[model samples]
Target: MTSTLQPVTALTLDLDDTLWPVRPTLIAAEKVLAEWLRANAPSTAQNTPPAAMLALRAEVAAEHPHWAHDLSAIRLETIRRALRKHGDDPALAELAFDVFFEARHAVTLYDDVLPGLERLASRYPLIAVSNGNAELHRVGLERFFAGSVSARLHGVAKPDPSIFQAACAAAKAPPHRVLHLGDDLDTDVAGALAAGLHAGWICRPDGAHADAAPRAGAHRFATLLDVADALGV
Candidate 1:
């Protein structure tokens, strides 16, 4: 006889690399944001090119450790600093960040993500837990999640047990009843395990690269579809 598995009360999901590839998404958003700056804030654009803009973000991060977990604030500050350096109105920073933020939501989900998440959502309440600033509502994925706990709001990022614990709380489940899915072994798997939750490593689709095995017990999923199957959702 096939053994039946217990259903998890809730799921804590990682947003960035788990739902979609984040690097290219950010790069594309940056390009559009730079174009906007060049058109409206010329001097600021001249003062902070793409490379220097990255440097400015790091500088701002170092100057305000409190804002380190708040990516939106860091980007806004970076723009404000750049505009102020170029003798532009610092208030324009919000407009500039809005440009980037809008572009940031223009993401292409991995083929398996949508269908898989939908299936999982039917079986369990999903809670978003991420260090990234990606807003699920903006990305049109909020419908699948019951709640969200972000680094910016919590004042801490993952690899720290607090964020994971916060997600479990949001999902109305204890840590042991929640399963966390993420692309990074260290941030997702190890962190979830450390927080006394089950962890699952979401392997990339191409199978070109494999991460190191997580220290604690965990599951490996080729796609979010595999995750649903494994969980019997």
Candidate 2:
């Protein structure tokens, strides 16, 4: 165990880029959505390309600031807007979103994730805390987690202390006794610190924050295996 690290009774983990490379997963899911749209809503598909769909999603998000924490809502609205703009049935958004969501859950986890999660889960009650809509059960990783706290369900996202507190509550641990691990510096490390929880920043080589220097009062690691080793799990 690292002497410098604080003792924690439970752990909160980030999903997307921490356990898996989210870009590829999202890209593949978008492709699946496009294909489904072409088959079911040909007019909408013909009118909206991938770039246009992204713009539509952004436009919807800007129009609905209150729904910022709910990505699923934004995505569904985007699909509906596309269908409506193209003279297609907006109700088909539900089925289109379902297709996209299923593809989104088809993630390829990092090599270190399984072993690291096994080690950590054996030692601590792991709670998934995510801003994304990826479901643990769909991702086939629910068994490793005691519970999950999501922005959609909680009405707040990370960088807001409430979500982290919710995760701590789910673990039945006080903020001081709950360590939160994630890849994003702002949402994960700083957010956990702000919430009075220990922070572990897992900076994978290919991550956006990979070149970031270590911050004071936050643990930095290259992989989940490194985090497990540091925690002596």
Candidate 3:
């Protein structure tokens, strides 16, 4: 007998690399943000190119080992330190954040995203869980997600149960009735499954590369359309 589609009341989705392609979009967004910062916030822009920011991130990782668990805090501290190192110009720092925020909203969703989300949203509450900044849900994705919890606000990230619990709490769904989807096995899939939610993997290739298996057991789809179909939405 064919299994019936379980009634899912909520969805907890991972942001980066799941709903949208991460590397190219982020890299392009960063480039745009850098140019904007250079024009509007020269002081902060002078020293912090992408490479510099990455290196500082590495240094920050070593300095505060605990931050690896919650990267949002690490991101905040990194921005603050970078601002201080650049003569502590608060206005310029604000401009930098503004630039980055605008660029982030400029993202292009996967072709399947809008339709898939619309179909899912018609039936269930949808929320996003990410290790990114708390503003992830507020940045023009309001049409899709009904709620969100990020590592910034929760003080914990994926692979840890707190973030997922918070998302389920926000959606008022028991873990078993919620479907959580993401691109990471160790973090998103494994973590959500461990927390009792059904988990799936969105495994689209960004460029020329491909992810190898070991992503079995989890439902896998190359596009959100496939996911929507799998859910019988």
Candidate 4:
């Protein structure tokens, strides 16, 4: 297949829904977190149901705009606040977060992801660029990436050119020489294009955004394997 790309030297990838079904992973993590809270902090668990916890998290995020890029901080504060409100020890928030984080890493990747990463990684330096707190090492995919640049570490999130620039720097390649592949149109495609990198939209068939239209000048693919094929890797 013909590629709408420049001579690509390095690649930046978005995590979350790009590699795995993030909603299921998140739901599972929330369940694990709720179970942990019930066992260790019954008061907080009793008062904070799933909906209440979601509201608390939203409230925490709204109160701390500076922490927009730090999902971990927002979640931790939300847990702390919930614990405090229910007369539970706020210190348990750390343990609760650990349980949630551990569960978050238990992601079942799309079938094409492993082979696609192998093919692409053989020819290009892969840099993970994401707004999430997922650790590649924890996900057992660290060896496929040259490095990672996350919103938590960079103090900026996607659609912001700075984080994209940081990913390019991590790959040791110019923006124009790097191709970024992701699922989100605005944060990944438009973001990479805005940062002068080629953008590839991974629109999996079962994805929630499967029907979303591709942006002008963006390459669209059904899977990571399609990306490797388009790149002739």
TM-score, prediction 2:
0.98
Query: Over 4 Å off in model 3, which ranges?
Result: 1-7, 40-48, 64-91, 134-139, 205-209, 214-216
Ranking by TM-score: 4, 2, 1, 3
Say what the RMSD of model 2 is.
Answer: 0.9
Model 4 over residues 144-229: C-alpha lDDT tens digits? 99999999999999999999999999999999889999999999999999999999999999998988878998999999999988
Residue pair clashes in candidate 4: none
List the candidate 4 regions with Cα displacement exceeding 4 Å. Answer: 1-3
In the range 170-228, model 2's lDDT, one tens digit per residue, is: 99999999889999889999999999999999998878888888767998888988988
Q: Number of backbone collisions per candidate, in order? A: 0, 0, 0, 0
Least accurate stretch of 10 residues (summed lDDT) in model 2? 1-10
As for lDDT, the candidate ahead, 1 or 3, is 1
lDDT, ranked from best to worst: 4, 2, 1, 3
Q: Global lDDT of each model?
A: 0.88, 0.93, 0.74, 0.95
Model 1 lDDT on a 0 to 1 scale: 0.88
